[model samples]
Target: MSVQRSWVIGAADCYNKNNVGLLIRKTACTLKPDVIISVDGDIIKIRSESTFKNHDTIFKLNEEFDEVTADGRKTKTTVTLDDGVLVQHQKWNGKESKINREAKDDQMVTTCIIGDIKAVRIFTKKN
Candidate 1:
């Protein structure tokens, strides 16, 4: 039998913003190749490899508001990528935000914000 390498990646409530009490914990694991696979959870995955030369990853967040807007107008926001790419703009249909990228060390420290609230998704290129 052949052995397979797997990584158990997870975070504790210690890192969660809502778990101030540290009572709630979340965890997950996956093989390196499975990085391209999507999972049903709030977690984001990043992978690195020689053949690929770079890693691509995305994170999404969705939230619903009591009202679409204070003035009853649809709220919209634009997102800019590290490459100076204006990926997309969002309008109030139950706000969904996403961050995507082709990994590069310099891009790791780069970021974008939606309105006044900073996005929680972060991708770092591996050296």
Candidate 2:
């Protein structure tokens, strides 16, 4: 049998909320301001981050499209910041085009794979 291994990195936090006349509860979780890296037969990576204060452009490409069979609301297919550019493809019969300056630097981070998997290793360090 083959086992799959994955790694996720991100910022997390714990929070406590109290309602009036109610007991307080505490919860802990990781926030999205972090990055997630996954490895499979191939490799996939995901990154989530806050917006950058400075101005910058990011690229995106359309990946998938979903529509209601009855209404046909027609939603555009989009990929989130594939590179430094944003590309929007029309749904169904729409044309494929690119949009410049669609993503601000503050909105997202870059994500990509290194190369084919030859070996895998992991280590942890304390700060």
Candidate 3:
């Protein structure tokens, strides 16, 4: 979407944190985080605020990059968008995770999956 949008957590489900890694665990615990997304051409920037810290990531579409997660783990990250859906893939330490985000009305719904453990976070778009 070529525009900056602010989003706030409207709902989340992250109960079984033990099934995932530290990064996902922290996210599971931070149920009500805030996020701001800026999309400009092929580049997308995402800034998120959690209970403990604020994280910012900037990446171009379909490009793979190295990302050190908030839990201090180094991971390879790639982001792509297709058919109005944004997908992110992460790999590290022989583990992998996928995240999908799509806009439904005025809300951005994100589904995070690591193995069979899935966490859903819904954010309401603002302004």
Candidate 4:
């Protein structure tokens, strides 16, 4: 079977961000690519010192999130999550999500406690 293309698209300083770096490294390790390619500058230097692989292909990014051709043609690219079936997030009629109904069920519990405390105060009559 042919391998699918897994491109890590990000800004020039994406490597500087901890979350972004971890994400890229995690993807690389998970995919286990023979050679890691960096279209940005610092990422290549950073990944080269990593445990994954010393082999790397460094290609400069012509723009922030665009690639230009030899004929000076600019094509815009974007990274996005896989789309799937939409599920209902909010409750119908503005109800809360997964509330503990048991708490509301025990409404009389607080009343009983307050009654007991009042009874004790009445008997003790401490000024």
Model 4 / residue 36 / CA error / Å? 6.9
Candidate 1 local lDDT, 1-127, one digit each (tens): 0001222212211223331133321221111222232334753333333232334333332332222221233545443333533243445667544333333323322122344434232333222
Off by over 4 Å in 2: 1-63, 67-73, 102-127
Q: Candidate 3 residues 1-127, lDDT tens each?
A: 6225889989988746545577667655765778898977877888888777788888998899988765666889998886777888999989999888888888999898888878788899876
Cα distance off (Å), candidate 3, residue 14: 0.7
> Distance (Å) between predicted and true CA of 61, model 2?
7.9
Q: How does model 1 score by TM-score? A: 0.25
State residue 94's C-alpha deviation in candidate 4, in Å.
Answer: 43
**Candidate 1 lDDT for residue 107:** 32
Ranking by lDDT: 3, 1, 2, 4
Model 3: residues with Cα > 4 Å off, grouped in runs: 2-4, 15-17, 20-31
Cα lDDT for residue 85, model 1? 31
Model 2 lDDT at residue 64:
58
When summed lDDT is taken over every stretch of 10 residues in candidate 2, the lowest stretch is 117-126
Q: Residue by residue across 14-105, what tens digits does model 2's lDDT show?
A: 22221212221121122223322223343222222323211111222234544221123344545433344423333444423222222222
RMSD of each: 13.3, 16.3, 2.6, 27.4
RMSD (CA, angstroms), candidate 1: 13.3
TM-scores of the candidates are 0.25, 0.21, 0.85, 0.15
- Segments of candidate 4 deviating more than 4 angstroms: 1-64, 69-72, 83-127
Model 1 pairs whose backbones collide: none
Sort by TM-score, best first.
3, 1, 2, 4
